[model samples]
Target chain A: MKDLALLEDNAPKPGLWTQIAHPGLFLGWSRHLIVPLAVITAALAAWGLYLSFWGSPPDYQMGDTVRIMYVHVPAAWLSQFCYAVMFASAIGTLVWRHPMADVSQKAAAPLGAAFTLLALFTGSLWGRPTWGTFWEWDGRMTSTLVLLFIYLGIIALWRAFDDQLKAARFVSVVTLVGAINIPVIKFSVDWWQTLHQPASVIRLDGPTIAPEILIPLLVMTAAFSMLFLTLHLVRMRTEVIKRRIRSLELAAARAAAGGAL
Target chain B: MRAFLAIVARDLRLGLRQGGDILTLVLFFVIVGTVLPFAIGPDRPQLARLAPAIVWVAALLAQLLSNERLFGSDFEDGSLAILRHAPLPLEMVVGAKMLAHWVLTALPIIAATPVLALMLGMEGETLLRAIGSLVLGTPALVAFGTVGAAVTVGLKRGGLVAPVLVLPLSLPVLIFGTGAMAPMVPGASGQALLLLAALGLVSVALVPFAAAMALRFAGE
Candidate 1:
């Protein structure tokens, strides 16, 4: 009995790190940040549009269609960024067992999918005027398509499980496993594109492109990043509240059962 | 070591005794291979051109057909529980099961590839390269599929989930496998073959630990 009592007394408690990482602590702060984040995103987006449409010069070779790069490139960057965040959250779920990590991962999937779809859509629209074809199975395009599929797969895995906790862990493992393909996709797509079309190699940010184009692209990228952060924070808060409600309902059901008995 | 061999032997025996599924996998491969020429028209040159891709895709799908059961039956019958409690590492248990799966499913597909190559009108050097690619690539396929199967083993309809989860992960294998047989690419085939072997080696080295963890989670 003494040993048992000592064991009880020495039981592990949530550490300082977990306490800091807890979603509830951020709940009030997130609500406050959302409005400011939205305003910043909107202001930047409006400024970005002004620069992209009016301030930026038309490309010497491609002309006005160069403006499409403002949307397509930023969406492409965010798609990869979102996956990287999900991958980090996966590591958190598996290694540190962080409570909020899985919630963040689950919240980020649809956003990543949306960004990937926008990249593909805007890319194809840009392609028709530039490449004379709307779609080409080149390395970058195909890999982006595969990335979209992966995002959908993760989302489907999230929906497949009825239990959120189990779903989170399973999704984490899947995310880490899928993380293996991200670099391969990037490398192979670049290599494939270079091999098939040696002349028309699309550089991510080449020095040849004037600074006028670069500034708007950077602004647009910032705007997209801020938007992702705001959405991710809102979704995470929703997930936490949903989980709390679920647990309360479970406890209430147990209490009612006990009373009836 | 002895426990690993025993688990492998036990699974192999169970697979051989229940061989109907093996037959189904083979038939699936043959049917998919045979139907492609008809769907694409009986153009001999086109069939020859598509033969390597067709064979690789069929092998991928056929191998996938059996992955859901890689751990499902053992898990359902409580054999996996006994293995879990045994005096051996769970990773070894998983490796042994995956090895048995490759033996039962992938070996038959490899053996049947030359025949599928013939049906697709591929000949001589192309058939040889196709076989070489399959031999090097299938281990990776089976390894990743085992991970998928382990992840979904707890679900009642995990079989459906296995392909979606595994297919994207297997893209590199598909690309390199087909790349290995593309005659138009001068020195690329050799590089692709080496990469495919590397992928297989990495998958062989890494997947068991991941699969074992997934199994443990499912067991919980």
Candidate 2:
């Protein structure tokens, strides 16, 4: 009747590490994925580097440094997009208590945090060459900072509990409810005269980018999405292993007591 | 409904008996207000610009300070179990607790803001907005804090944990509560008010059931 005790008793059979550690087997389920993702990412980075130096056109407005958009834009886009995934997963967990929803929530936090950092880093990089300063209290940046804080909050809340299940549930609920910030960030530019430009790529009508630019941007977006997937699979595997190890340790202690008896 | 009122009144009496609790919150508010002006320096214009936010933040911290005891006393004394078993729906019980919380904690914070306003040299239209916003806003804070307190109430060290868990959820209130008073600031105070009201309505409708469920889980 005690769920935690039952979970400990049913801990994954030993050697889960050996099971997943094989490079070929590990890469099998992900081979089609690993090869294509790597190829595309490298190609895009190459294309981006090429464009940064040679092939790509300059921003009529922003000039050569606008090239940072290749990285910055996708990072910002994915950061917000990852939050949307986290929020959805949070809702799923809170409303239905789906088991996988916890995995999804746990997986999404660090990804979102990484994306946020990428956006800020590339943003600062782009800003230095373009805006003559690296940081500003513009609404977009402020909300991005808020997004980072929310991510940190999620991680902190998750770590605050001694009981993992309780911590997961608590953080899950908070993430879903706190998602009100996503829309707020998107509309911040429109609502306030933010220094960040209004939406140019995703719009009600359609994307306004020239095909030449749009293609690379879309490719990069795909590459980043795949990167998140690959990282997610690895992280979730690690979490599952970690949980199994914890249960095994607990079971060992319990078994030693039974033997003593 | 009458039973609910009785519960509310009973809670109010308990709150009154523990008068020092509310007094401590007001004292925290006063001390926080006093320290902020000195910390930020004596420039009047800067104070005027910062006063609304500072007051709201201090109020939030004080509310959080008081939130630890919100359900802990009753939950520990087995009173919460009695309330849960009572004929009233958990939502009603939650509502009553939220009302008691507002009466004890938020009401004083709302009242204290005007005094803080005076101390910080706030004048005219902004002062009125500060009072108006807090009056409209703090109920939602109390309601939201009730849910948060309920969620974490069963955990050890939950008091410290609750604020970090709740603050992000409380941002809309903070953003708007301060926005309502700081007129030149770009946030839509009216929209923020609407959101705060909606938050109160939703929390009132849902939180007691949620709290009840969380309590069950925690107790188990």
Candidate 1, B36-109: lDDT as tens digits = 88889989999999998899889988988888889888899898988988889899998898889989999888
**Which residue ranges in model 2 land beyond 4 Å of their true spot?**
A1-55, A180-207, B185-213
Tens-digit lDDT string for candidate 2 (A142-261): 678778877877777667677776666676656655665456434533344321243332111155777666666666676677677767766665665566566677778888888999
- C-alpha displacement of A239 in model 2, angstroms? 0.8
Give me the displacement of residue A261 in model 1, in angstroms: 2.3
In terms of docking quality, how is candidate 1 classified? medium
Error of 2 at A103 (Å): 2.1
TM-score of each: 0.94, 0.83
Question: Candidate 2 on B1-220: residue-level lDDT in tens?
Answer: 8879988899899999989988888999889988998989999989988888888888888987888777898888888888777888776777788788788888888788778888888887788877777777787677567757877767776766777766666666676677566455455666556655665666566656666656655554
Query: What does fnat come to for each candidate?
Result: 0.23, 0.17
What class would a CAPRI assessor give candidate 2's docking? Answer: acceptable
